[model samples]
Target: MSDTKSAVGYTRLSQTSDASIPDQKREIRNLADREGFALLNIYDDGQRSSGFDAERPEYLEMQAELETGEVDVLVVRDRDRLSRDKRERSMFYYDLDEWDVELWTTTDGRVEFTDDESWLIEMIRNYMDDVTKRREIQKAKKKVQERVDNGYWQGRPPFGFRLDSDKRYLEPDPGKFDTALTVLQMRENGATWSEIEDETGVSAGTISRILDNEERYLSHVE
Candidate 1:
């Protein structure tokens, strides 16, 4: 085992990010200095989630180098920065162990492969991270369902509707309601989507959807 080795840092900022990539990199750099490792390169996965996505471009590139025994040290701000999934994290650890590469972290310092406590701590953290992601996703789905039940559009409004003044609910566009109705009536009278589009100047896709008024319209309203 070498006393000093070439190191590369990996960092991630999620899609719903708070611009923490710089802070993560700074911590990794500090760790490199404290450990006397040569900080050779840094990789970032910006606006990407470690929980949902299996592939991150820069992270994979780093893994390729790690596989070839090029990076003697792999540093991260935290273990979850590598992956929220325990399986992926284990795969990375396996590769590092196979290559005799050392793992370093700003939070945990240098890892000792024989330390069972360190391994358990990592497993717990990864489990917690995954749980948090699942909870967040469930919460978001519930919120969207609530909005839909309350007659508020959860996402962008259709062509014949616009957001209310508060932007919390979709209201029928007074200017476009008649056009939507016309499309529906024409379709009912055996008009093709393109024919309806040509007649009403609305796109064929929107016209097709408008024909399914229940999907794109609020009940008890035009």
Candidate 2:
């Protein structure tokens, strides 16, 4: 972020989360100001996911621009803002070399990045990113189980019955719920799994799962 450096801020937001985008931009802007960097452009990919499997539109666009030698630095909120994948993380390492653009990141209120000893810095960054992503996944899985154990619906809310509600509780849809009940009844009535699946238009696997769900069967009885 030296005065000699010119930068562009690259930001991405998940498709459903624009609520915090303003704060993200503000954080980047403040950093640019404090660091005395002449910001070249603000490249924003709204409603885009930056996970490893997907390449964000604005991110790709910025890459094209960088390849043309447009930016000297790329700034973001954190390592995860770019990616959570170790392989995708390597893209940054190489891309910076190709474009001669330094990656600048601020996490926990401090600006960090590579320097003369950049490879060493990148190695540590790569390690920390992997650790962070692993812990995040584990935490998400545990939260799902915790919600299920607390008698709340677990995992992402399925279609129907207020899917967007913040609360974890399930409100069984009348149509699907009835189908669910019949599937369970058929199972207990000694119907073949495939027979129940055909009757309910539910996937055979889904039918088997609903039939096996102790909570759903108890509620079906109630």
TM-scores, one per candidate: 0.67, 0.59
Q: Let me know the TM-score candidate 2 reaches against the reference structure.
A: 0.59
Each candidate: RMSD? 5.2, 7.8
Candidate 2 lDDT (Cα, 0 to 1): 0.69
Point out where model 1 deviates above 4 Å.
1-3, 17-19, 156-165, 170-222
**Model 2 Cα RMSD, 1 decimal:** 7.8
> Candidate 1: RMSD over Cα atoms?
5.2
lDDT of 1 at 209: 74
Best by lDDT: 1
Candidate 1 lDDT, 83-192, residue by residue in tens:
87767877778678898888888987877676788777766766778788778879989998987888776777777788889878777888687788788778779988
